[model samples]
Target: MRRIYHRFPQQIDLDFELARPFRDVLSCIARLHNTHTTSKGSGGLVKERMIIQVADGRTQFLDLDDLIPLSEKTSEAVDFRVDFQRTLLTPEKRLPVAENVFYLRIVDKGPVTECYAAKESPHGDMDAMDLRTFLKGACE
Candidate 1:
């Protein structure tokens, strides 16, 4: 297979200062069109939200959440949340990949690497990271 050389940047740096303003904007967007159904006693209200289901073929999503200011992520910010379930899960029952706690989404033709040294093996650091739910306690 042709290689994706690490001539470009491998990691992205996020400024902690830029988070609050972005959070305000995401909050406004989440409250726009979603209809509030009913209150869940103490859990607040449950509303059908607009979620952005991103198909991560290139595996750039390893940093997509960090690209946004995800410090105060909630179901209310579903519009800005990104779901990376590429292989998808059956509604019948929650499934596990390879019977492991970590869901193996893909073999990762091009995986995450800190640097491309002379002897840097592509598979040295396993690309299989624990699935992080975009929304808190709302991952299905």
Candidate 2:
């Protein structure tokens, strides 16, 4: 059987850069904090141990051990993105441009798993940048 990282109670802090234009980061935060999940059958019929409460929403089953390493990796990568975006957008500060954007993402590199964002706003067309690459790189 394959081992999957189950959802677990976690406190996460996400940050984005604000050098010029602004960006939306709320939706991704909401999604990350409110999703429900459970882990079962990985070890062949063992009872679950941990639960995740979404503060303002539902409950979920998750694993604490898996989150520790993942969270560490995520935190390091996020800081890198913040620095990159700030340097890139510094010259383009303008209205209708989101100055800062940040959110949480859940990534499962397993069969039937997926990538999700907490909040998002439409990133308008503009050369000199690709938002998807920035976000995806941070998460991956």
Candidate 3:
């Protein structure tokens, strides 16, 4: 089975850079859970884990334990992308909002060189420069 390293909540945006190599592929697991309560059960829950190739600019979704080999001789930086879907549950008569809970996790990597979780805002700017700046000053 694949291992999870990082997790993020639903509807929240996340940005990070991978600058290291591991024995296997880098990945992220996204989980979604509905908060609505029904007489039948609690709510709906869904999970999607994608094996990501950090060096590639496009998004590549993979199955569980799927391995994407990395060239040890090559030196390149990797970027991560996580896309979430909207929910279909709503209270009484309010509009249905995409408010599911989610999380992100990386497989087997020992330690991440850098990771950043963008602030949750209705109009927050999650830009590349802002992420770089946040990572730069995170530990300081």
Q: Write model 3 residue lDDT over 19-136, tens digit each, in one string.
A: 4333322311111111123322235432222222231323342332233333232222233333322333445432333321222323333544344343333432234344445334
Q: What alpha-carbon RMSD in Å does predicted model 1 have with respect to the real structure?
A: 17.0
RMSD of 3: 11.1
Candidate 3 stretches with Cα past 4 Å from truth are 1-67, 70-76, 89-96, 99-112, 119-140
Worst window of 10 by summed lDDT in candidate 1: 99-108
lDDT of residue 89 for candidate 2 = 22
lDDT of 1 by residue, 63-123 (tens): 3333233324321212112222222134454332211112111111222212111211222
- On lDDT, the candidate that comes out on top is 3
How would you encode candidate 2's per-residue C-alpha lDDT over 1-140 as one tens digit per residue? 11122332133333234221111222232223323323233232222111222211113323323333333223211111111121122234412222233233333332222323222233423221343444344333
Candidate 1 stretches greater than 4 Å from native = 1-20, 36-71, 74-140
TM-scores vs. true structure, each candidate: 0.17, 0.23, 0.28
Give the candidates in order of lDDT, highest first. Answer: 3, 2, 1
| CA lDDT, every model vs. true structure | 0.24, 0.26, 0.32
Looking at candidate 2, the ten consecutive residues that score lowest on lDDT are 76-85
RMSD of 2: 20.0
Q: lDDT score, residue 132, model 1?
A: 26
Cα lDDT for residue 110, candidate 1? 25
Q: Give the C-alpha miss distance for residue 65 in model 3, angstroms.
A: 12
